[model samples]
Target: MWKILKYSFADLVRSRWSYVYLAFYLILGFSLLFLNNDLSKTVITLMNIVVVLTPMIGTIFGIMYFYSAREFTELLLAQPIKRRNIFLGQYLGIALSLSLSLVLGLGIPFLIYGIAQSSEIWDFGFLLLVGTFLTFIFTALSVNISLRNENKVKGFGYAILLWLVLAVIYDGIFLISLVLFDDYPLDRFTLAATMFNPIDLSRILVLLKLDISALLGYTGALFQNFFQGSGVFISLGMLVLWTVVPVKLLLRKAIRKDF
Candidate 1:
């Protein structure tokens, strides 16, 4: 597993896209910090982008890597190595590479700006943590999609569709549902629904941590009140489950897949 992981990680790290990914984050981080000059606000803005962008990147990269390495993967399958190790190593490699891009991209600017001296340190840390989780979760999902669909085009299509539903359409549907049923109490319903989507959970978690859930209006306040206590733990727990389940499914599929 480690060997496969090391190879995949090194392969991606040496790729031009990896440099571009890292540079983009670095540029964005510095730009945001330069323009905003406020750690809390910057962290909030970053939270919005990280939650959406990481998953998309993860999905695209995972599927792309899987398909691109198909020949190599088959060669490995012909060897005596465990299928679980091969797939998991590749998955982790893609996820970690992306996560590294995210961290270094954002971390450099923040650290330069002296986030260590700021009160938003934990908030910023949590934001990166959530981004990493999203990367891992989505990468695993995309790999699963690739494994299930032998056609590269179909795999890419399904991966993007999955991201769209979770990132954009899911929020749209959630809001529409809330409006349609506004006559009744929706606190618990809203909470339950948010838990269903990792994106929503991430947004809420960061907002709550940054002490700015008020911008979410009544809904935000409701989230603040409910999650203000032990609720953060519950949300984090859900994110953990989100990250773990997809990888489990990926491994299960990989082990049983016919090469």
Candidate 2:
């Protein structure tokens, strides 16, 4: 597993897209900070981007890597190796490489800007943490989608559709439901609904950590009171579950796949 992970990560790290991805963040980080001159607001901007972009990138990259590496995967399968390790290694490699791009891209600028001395350090850190979780969850999901569908077009279609539903459509429906049932209490409904989508879960996590009272509003206040201490753990646990469930399904599919 380690060997496969090492080589897979190396392969992806060497690709031009990796550097492009890294440079994009480097540029985004510096530009956002220089323009706003506020770490807290900059973090909010990043949160919005990370919540939507990471999963979409993860989904596209996961399926792309799977199909692109078909020949390589076949060669690995021919050797005496556990099927799970091969797929898992590849999945981790793509996820980690993308994650590195995100971290280094954003970190260099913030560190230079003196985030260490700033009080928003934890908030920024939590933002990055959520981004990493999102990378893992979506990559695993994309890989699972790829494994199930051998056709490239269909796989890509399904992956994008999955992202769209979670990122945009879900929020649309959630809002409509809130309006439709405006008279009834929706505190628990809203809370549970947010957890169901990783993107929403991440957004709420950052908002809660930042403690923007205005943004958190009434519902946010309710969550603040309910979660206080253990709520962080609960949210993180759900993100972990989001990543684990898909990867476990991927492993199961890999094991049974007639590679």
Candidate 3:
């Protein structure tokens, strides 16, 4: 598993698209920070970028990686290796490589600015966790989608659509719900909605750190208190679930796959 993961990581690093993507993220991160001189504004902009871009990049890269490696995957199947190991190795390799790039591309700038400005370390830490976990979640989902379809275009499209639904459409639905339920107590509903999408959870976590939970209304306050009371462990558990569930489903498919 370790060897396979290392090789997979190396392959990812050598890909031209990897460099392109890294440069794009780095430029965007620096640009956003430069445009917003205020720490709170900077954090909000960073969070928005993370919530929107990280998953899109993760999903597209993951689908492309697996589809491009179809031949390699087939060759590996011919060897005496467990399907679960191969799938997991590849998954971990992609997750780690992309997550590392994200940290270097976005995280370093955020840290430098945060430290120089004497900003809250907790917000920076939360951003790091959110970025990595968001990658893991999208990668896992993308791998599952890739394995389910033979056509690379179709698989990639499905992954992008899934991301759109979760990251963007879900928020729209929540907004509509809030408008419809203006007279009802919807804090619990909003909490449930946040749980359904990791992007929203990530936003809530960062907003809470800035002491702006009240702006989120009742549901935002609930999430703020939830994270504040539970801290890193809760977020870690959520992230672990995000990675584990989809990978587990994919592993079951891989083990039973005729190939």
Candidate 4:
């Protein structure tokens, strides 16, 4: 497994796309800091981009990696190695490569700007953490989609559709539902809804950490107050669940799947 993992990691790290991903982050980080010297404000702006963009990139990368490597993967399948190791290693390789791009891309700018001396270090770190979580979660989902669909086009469609629903459509539906039933109490409903969508849960979690109560409004305040001291921990737990379940499903499917 480690050997397979190492190979995949090395292979991806060497890809031109990997360098492009890294360069993109480097530019984004420098640009954001150049435009705004405020670290916290920069982090807030980044959170919006990270939450949506990371997942989409992860989804695209996951689908692309799995399909591109299909021939090699099939070759590996004929060997005595376990299917779980092969797929999981590939999945981890893609997720970690993307996470590395995000960290280095954003981390370098902040580090140079003196985030360590600033009060927003933890907030910045949490933002990166959330981005990493989103990457892993979406990568796992995309890999699962790829595993299920033998056709590359179909896999890409399903993966993008998954991202769209969670990132955009889900929020629209949630807001509409809230407006339609505004008269009734929605605290529980809101909380429950937030939990179901990793993106919403992550946004609320970061906003709560930033202590941006004004932006959080009613729902954010409720989450902050409801979770109280344990808000970050609870949200982290949910993100873990989001990442693990898809991974588990991926492993299971790989194990029983006919290559």
Candidate 5:
């Protein structure tokens, strides 16, 4: 597993797309800071981008990696290795590389701007953490999609559809549902709905931590009321579950799968 992980990470690091991702973030970080010297404001702008972009990119990368690595995966199946380990290692490698790209890409500019001396360090750290979590969650989801679909085009299509539903469509439905049933209490329903979608959960979690949930209006207030206390821990646990469940399911599938 470790060897596979090491090679996978190395291979990805050497890829052109990896460098492009890193460069893109580097430019984004520098540009955001240049446009706005306020770290807090920059973090907010980044939050919007991170919440949507990371998951989409992770989905795309996961699907592409799984399909591209098929030949390699087949070669590994002939070796004395557990199928789950192969997939898990590849999955982890991709997630870590992308997470690293995000952290360093955004972190470097912040550090140069003396973010360490500022009060927004923790907020910035939390942003990176959520980004990492999204990367893992979405990548695992994409891998699952890829594993189930042998056709590359169909796999890519499914992956994009998954991202779209989670990142965009889910929020639309949640809002419409809230509007349609505005008279009734929706605290529990809203909370459950947020938990079901990683993107929503992440946005709420970060905004709650930044103490800006109030800006979101009613739903924000509800999130603030709930997440301000021990609910934060619960939110974190859900994020962990979001990452773990898909990974576990994919691993199980990988084991019984015909390679």
Candidate 6:
């Protein structure tokens, strides 16, 4: 398992796409800081970038990795190694490699700026955790879809559409709901709405930490107060659910697969 993980990490490190992804984030982070010397502005910019890019890269590369490794997976199945081990080893390897890239790409820059400006490290830490978990969640989803379907294009399309729905469409719905429920106790509804979309929860979590939840309106304040205590654990647990359930279903399918 260790050997497989080592090789998988090496492969990811050698991939030009990984470097390009890292460079893109690093440049974006630095550019934002250069453009705005304000710590709050830098943190907000970083949060937005992480929220948008982390899942995008994770899904795309994760699907590609699984699909491209079909031949390798087949060869491994021929060996004496257990199928479960191979599946888990590959999943962990990919998750770790991608998480490391995200940490380096976004976390490190945020840390440098945070320290220099004496910013709140907790907020930045929360951002890093969000990016890491988001990557894991999306990667698991993409890998599951890829394994279940033979066509890489279709699998990849599913991931993109899923992202769009969770990140964009869901928010649009939330806005419409806010308009419709103008007088009701909408705070609870907002919280319930967040449960339906991890992206919404993540965005609320980050902004709440930055003391910017007010921008989200009344429901945002409710989210801020509700998640302010043990909310971190709840959010983390939700992320774990997002990763585990899909992978569990996928693994069951893979084990029973004729390949």
Taking all chains together, each candidate's TM-score versus the true structure is 0.96, 0.96, 0.90, 0.96, 0.97, 0.91
lDDT of 5 by residue, 1-259 (tens): 9899988999998899889999999999999999999999899999999999999989999999999999999999999998878888999999999998999999999999999999999989999999999999999999999999999999999999999999999899999999999999888899999999999999988887675666655665666667877778898899999999999999999998876
Report the lDDT tens digits of candidate 6 across residue range 1-259: 7777777878888889878877887887778777886767677778887898788878888888999998999999999987777887787788888888777876666667764457566677778899988888888888888888887778888989988888798899889989998988777776778876777778878887886657555545556667876776787788788888877877887788898
The Cα local distance difference test for each model comes to 0.92, 0.91, 0.82, 0.90, 0.91, 0.80
Give the distance in Å from residue 85's predicted Cα in candidate 5 to where it truly belongs. Answer: 1.4
- State in Å the error of residue 236, model 6: 2.1
How many residue pairs in model 5 have overlapping backbones? 0
Off by over 4 Å in 4: 214-221
How good is model 5 by TM-score?
0.97
Clashes in model 6: which pairs? none
The 10-residue segment of model 4 with minimum total lDDT is: 211-220
* Model 5, C-alpha of 105: deviation from truth (Å): 0.5
Where in model 2 is the C-alpha error above 4 Å?
214-221
TM-score of 3: 0.90
Clashes of 3: 0
Candidate number with greatest lDDT: 1
lDDT of 1 by residue, 1-259 (tens): 9999999999999999999999999999999999999889999889889999999999999999999999999999999999989998999999999999999999999999999999999999999999999999899899999999998888899999999999999999999999999999998899999999999889888887776666655664676777877788888899999989999999999898778
| Candidate 4: pairs in clash | none
Q: On a 0 to 100 scale, what is the lDDT of residue 115 in model 2?
A: 99
